[model samples]
Target chain A: MNVAKRNNVTVTGQRGAPVVMLAHGFGCDQNMWRLVVPALAEHFEVVLFDYVGAGRSDLSAWSEERYASLDGYARDVVEICRELDLRDVTFVGHSVSSMIGVLAAAREPGRFARLVLVTPSPRYIDDGDYRGGFSKADIEELLESLDANYLGWSATMAPLIMGNPDRPELGQELTNSFCATDPDVARVFAHATFLSDNRADLAAVAVPTLILECTQDFIAPREVGAYVHAAIPGSTLVTLDATGHCPQLSAPEATAQAILSFTGAAP
Target chain B: MCRTEQEQEPERAGGDGSLTQDAAFTALLEDSAVDLYENAPCGYLSTLLDGKIAKINSTLLAWLGYTREQVVGRMSFTDLLTVGGRLYHETHYAPLLRMRGEISGIAFDLRAADGSRLPVLVTSAVKTGTDGQPLLIRTSVFDARDRRAYESELLRARKEAEEARREAEEARLRAERERERLQNVLVTLQRSLLPPVLPEIPGLETSAHYHTASPDRLGGDFYDLFSLGDGRWGFFLGDVCGKGPAAAAMTSLTRYSLRAAAIHDPDPVTVLTTLNTVLLERYTGREPRFCTVVFGVLEPEGEGFTLTLASGGHPPALLLRAGGGAEYLPTPGGVLVGVLPHPPFTRTSTVLSPGDTVLMYTDGLTEARVDSGRALFGDGALLDFAARLAPATAKDTITAVTGLLHGFGDGLDDDTATMAFGVPASGAAGKPA
Candidate 1:
């Protein structure tokens, strides 16, 4: 399979410039990078793609065994890098994709130059001595809510989301394809994202990393960000003034400025 | 009314008829807006991007049983949810809404002023300003108490189905164990029906074998060697037409009757004739019991035995000679025993000289299948086998035929009973063939 076509990869910006690959988090697709991409494209070549089973990427490539863990997603990222012959690349990831980037960078250290984690959490379940912000039962209830909501979302959005891409609607319909996914695949993706524990993998990330912590992020709180920053060596920590979990959507200008400063791209 | 208002407006300078009508319409619209916001079916609220409550409808306040003064500008949106609902909302719901700019059907439990939990479905959207910046979050909520009740019922039904499937699997396993126990009991009973060891006849070597086609169903084939009287011995090999307890009972009767009749008369033909009369008389008007048998009486003669055999629709005996040659001692024209009242039997006599072996068997040998039942191990194959083992003792003959039967594997589907008698060549008892 062509890795670039499987992920619906779209590359833009200056030719032969430093590569910046942007990956979206759960509950969204590659379209979530709309606000941050325009600013980064000025100095660096920006690469964007959807994970398998999301957005306009091919859903036929999905299988239960290959995607049973975050490692499966990490393999896709490494394959994407290999397919596009990317090196010294700056990987920008949001939410769960942040950990995927961590795993990928640790596996292929020579290919990545720096890492940017947006509201990343190494562990979401709260342990005895650590506050990861959620309990095991809470995650179960969240899965139930997703099950109910995904059923409703599929029914209301299938025609407008799946078919409208070919024959574009003139007006009225929202163009952004966030949270557009098959409900079955979304269920498996949710389990893989929320239940993963990559705390031990933090110290193995030899590349320079920047942890972009949103001020009032409900998903990854400030403490989790501090724990990650402390674990990864030679990593910088910047707390944004954004009020929500997704600064890329809620506060994109601040998000772009942080990425530019950390990677030494022109502001 | 317009003309009168227009005339009166002229008196009150600068007061036009349209201006008076506009004031009245504005008053009506204001009253309708207040009533609609307060009494809409769904609850409405607006929160600052930080999640602090900015405004709330009277409908929501009524549902929570809280007054406006206690909630507005005081409680945040997540503060109203139960502990579990708050955790879920913070982790999943908020992230989704922030990324998508909107979220729908987020189920939560709101803790009311009286401490009772109220189920609700909430949808929220970020309200943006003209500069495309989010100003506040607008939310609408609907009661989901009925839907929660339905989901719980569905969960209960699923659990019940899982329980029933587990019980059915256990029941099937128990039935399989019971069948295994009964099969073991049948095997024990069948083993007891055959002789534990063949009897030793002086001056002659004897061997025998019995192979059952099924372990659960009792086989009807039987063979025995017994002393008659006064330098004489009687032996017989037979197969009943049917199987199980009925045929087993007939086999026992035939065996005892043959020995008794041979002792009284000491003649092979008369002994079989007596067995035919006994079976035909016992089962005349009932289920007709029948069998094919080869009965023999032997007398000692000069380091060997002289044998007289009677056949009743049975396969012929093979004589392996002392000079390394083998042929069948045919006893033709014999009727099937126990089927007719006066069935004539055929008698043939042969001498078991030193190094000579005589084998008597039921049709189960020639009728045995080979190659997964595609072909039969016919009588022609048995004839060639005996000729190859010429100058053989009784034990050697029986051992070779048993080995041939074992080679059939699953193809041998019938019970076989065979008996072989020889003179052992005087001094060849201790040597291997």
Candidate 2:
């Protein structure tokens, strides 16, 4: 559970250069960057650490009272940047971590130079003017499934990943990683990631940004990624031919190349 | 599936095309009824008017762990409920549903096959046909396990918050009560240090008043008037350096010592010197306590009184002349008592003519703060107040100063003690000009 500690940092291609801080999403930790790091670390100094409750990080730091909201996670990101004295950081975020970084960068604009959002979503529940993939009733069914098979969440969630699965076992291996997290911690994080709405913060980002969209994703669809790009000022939108949520694991070469070209780092 | 095909075969034998279509539609309706009755999410059940179970859907039957033959004719709907749920159904649920012809979302419990209780919400409605006659009762049921859990959590949080709030309020109340008790003890001790009514000195109108800034806290002011030997009167007013029960104890000692010393020698200087020795002996420890007192002895003279005043670090007395002039009767070279072995006590003699008032007050009056824009109501303001009513009696001066003390609003942050003795100007004691 020492994932909060920085294990290894690679700065292969450049010295005394701008930093690229990568924050992972709900289930996975900093290990999600194993494939993309070898390519981007050749040019930029890659900073990685797990969220306190995720992976092998310190579980004692996760407090139900304090971490009841996503703001606690976002504040930790800002404090970590301050502790490392990182400036002009090109923040790379995946899944729900994208909004976490967006909030952190909005709170302190001077710390972050740019943002590379991967499969970002603002509001997952649709209002009258919005159309998220699932309806409220569908989400209720998902909650019921979670409660019914409290022990078999991973086995059930794997098959529900995509409608057309050319790689069915890929979803199973990815869900196997999800089951590694403590069920209680996973439950709280599930509520926090799905229930948060940061749509208002999309326009306030004053940094250069790039948003990578999956062509076929059940969670964050192409329309949703396009909407995020439209709301954020001066942000570029790039689409990749990946299907599943863990794009770096599904297609690492394309994801790393996009990050390198957007950051203008030699790879 | 075979039964459905057998039922649809006779409909295909009809020669007319429209008749054949009607027969096929009837077969489709029957198939949909089986699906709806078996797979519906809500529990549907029917009971006789007397509460006997007549028919039930597959959902309700599966929930109760009973087959079609077990409960259809043998038991009533109340048989599936727990003891308390059954009682409520009879007393509250049955009567309300009967009077209203419908009742919805009434929470109850049902006993399952394994004797475990199942929480459920039920909505029962009396099914009536075309003639408006009461028929069988149809009820819909929903599982309430999740709602009940949520409700219990909300109740727990509410009870915890209420307990925390009550504990905080109790602490505040105890603090307030302690302050009130301290103030009561101080007021009782202060009264014991002064005479109830200033000895009814002949040819003299004497009056005294004490004003407290806060009734729930103690103050350090003291005053008294008592008879010396051979028709000479002794009086003193002083303010201690601190507050609470300690100040009240010192005020009592000072009042008694001055009264006893003045009997042997009615000179104000000797009376204060005796008090100084008593105070210095009583307070010999580190951080010794002390006070400022002004002692006076009044003796009858021609058309006026001879007043000898002695001060121990006390303010000068204000002497109001009969013809409307006010000035401080100076008694200099006085230091606070109890700080040293021998303290210098200053004595001065002044004759108050008839119809003149002498006012002795604690510094609380001079140090009172008023409006935000003005300076403190200082000694100059008090002198001007005394001059405005020069031709007033002792009672008039005392009453006027008491009203002035109240007029300070929240400005008077300490206790005030005032005593005035003089001959009356007119008929009544407090009849103002």
Candidate number achieving the greatest lDDT relative to the actual structure: 1
Worst 10 residues of 2 chain A by lDDT: A1-10
lDDT of 1 at A197: 90
Clashing pairs in 2: A13-A42
Candidate 2 runs further than 4 Å off: A1-267, B1-31, B159-183, B426-433
TM-score of chain A, cand. 2: 0.82
Give one digit per residue, the lDDT tens place, for model 1 in A209-267: 99999888777999999999999998999999986677887788999999999988854
Model 2 error, position B76 (Å) = 1.3
RMSD of each: 11.6, 24.1
Against the true structure, candidate 2 has what lDDT?
0.75
Give the DockQ-based CAPRI class for model 1: incorrect
TM-score of each: 0.60, 0.56
**What fraction of the real A-B contacts shows up in model 1?**
0.24
